[model samples]
Target: MSANKKNFQVPYTGVTKIQVGKKLGTSRLYIQTPSETYKFKFQFIKLEQVESSIRSFLPSSVLIESGQLD
Candidate 1:
């Protein structure tokens, strides 16, 4: 049932206890995933904005999007 959006992935280490419900973030926003039952803090990623940029899913032909790839 895992979608595995593949937007961002962070490897889990021993210290990070994997559980079903946990929080992950660093100020901006925190997202909770249904399955962390063996994974730790994988990695912090702003996937939607970041991924969209990479995939060129923007409407502006000029791609004037700034602050991305920061």
Candidate 2:
């Protein structure tokens, strides 16, 4: 994950979009920024944990929903 961070920085302010999906059997969290979309694979972290962590940083106005990407 550290290696992927070199490509883009997560925004400190501004409304960001979040999505979750499964790719090739790996669960991933997708963060959509103004210019690019960042993907983070979670092998150990549960879906609920990820949602909670992201919610801590974002404002209540930013809706965080949990569902399978299909």
Candidate 3:
């Protein structure tokens, strides 16, 4: 739900936008912050479940965009 590595963390509050959709026949997740945009490819994983998890962790102020994957 959150991104963490060693001593670095990207808090949910820092997230400005989230986008879920298919690109080039691949399911992708895009998270945007003030200065960065992270892209993740969903392979063999359920995107809806992932989205739900992310939604649960994110603030209501964050914008989430959902697109049809089919």
Question: How far is each candidate from the true structure, as Cα RMSD in Å?
Answer: 13.8, 3.9, 4.3
Q: Which residue runs of candidate 1 sit more than 4 Å off their true CA positions? A: 1-45, 57-70
User: Which of the numbered candidates is closest to the native, going by highest TM-score?
Assistant: 3
TM-score of 1: 0.18
Model 3 Cα RMSD, Å?
A: 4.3
Alpha-carbon lDDT of model 3: 0.76
Error of 3 at 6 (Å): 7.7
Ranking by lDDT: 3, 2, 1
Could you give candidate 1's per-residue lDDT for residues 4-51 as a string of tens digits?
A: 765555332212321122244421222223454322232454534433
Greater-TM-score candidate between 1 and 2: 2
Q: All candidates' TM-scores?
A: 0.18, 0.64, 0.65
Better of 2 and 3 by lDDT: 3
Model 2 agreement with the true structure over 1-70: per-residue lDDT tens digits: 5688576556556437787656565667887778776778888667767777778877777776456764
Per candidate, the number of residue pairs that clash is: 1, 0, 0
**Candidate 3, which ten residues in sequence have the lowest lDDT sum?**
1-10
Clashing pairs in 1: 10-42
Best by lDDT: 3
